[model samples]
Target: MITAIVLIQTVADRLTEAAQEVADIDGVAEVYSCAGDVDLIAILRVTNHEDIADIVPGRINKVAGVLDTDTHIAFRSYSSQDTEATFSLGLE
Candidate 1:
């Protein structure tokens, strides 16, 4: 799977609505409203790179009140869950 992290900026008054709309889009896996340079963070998981173009500009950007989006394709993923699972293998 290809994962993309989208940093979204929305109209001040429509932040929540915009996030819901983006989350409803097909490829979006999760959406988080956060404090930082961007208003919302959307995680997208898809089968290929082309899907990023289709989901981001084609769907996400078109949601009402979405002002702008900055998307980054993930080259690798590292997490404590993965590490824990790796270390626990064969322990059962």
Candidate 2:
């Protein structure tokens, strides 16, 4: 799967509404409202890179309150669980 991290900026007053709308999009796996340089962060997982183009510019950017977006495509994923599992492979 292709994973994309999207940093979103939305109209201040419409933050909640925009987040809900983005969360409802098909390719969006998760949406988080945060306090920082960006208002919301969306996690998108799809089967192909082409889907990122269609989902981000074609849909997300068109949402009513969305002001701007910066998207990053993930090359690799590392988590504590993954690391632990790798190190403990023979312990089980």
Best by TM-score: 1
Off by over 4 Å in 1: 87-92
TM for every model, in the order presented, reads 0.91, 0.88
Which pairs clash in the backbone of model 1?
none
Clashing pairs in 2: none
- Give me the runs in candidate 2 sitting further than 4 Å from their true place: 84-92
- Whole-model Cα lDDT of every candidate shown, in order: 0.94, 0.96
Error of 1 at 31 (Å): 0.3
Which whole-number lDDT from 0 to 100 does residue 15 have in model 1? 94
State the lDDT of candidate 1 residue by residue for 1-92, as single tens digits: 99999999999999999999999999999999999899999999999899999999999999989989999999988989878887885755
Residue by residue across 3-31, what tens digits does model 2's lDDT show? 99999999999999999999999999999
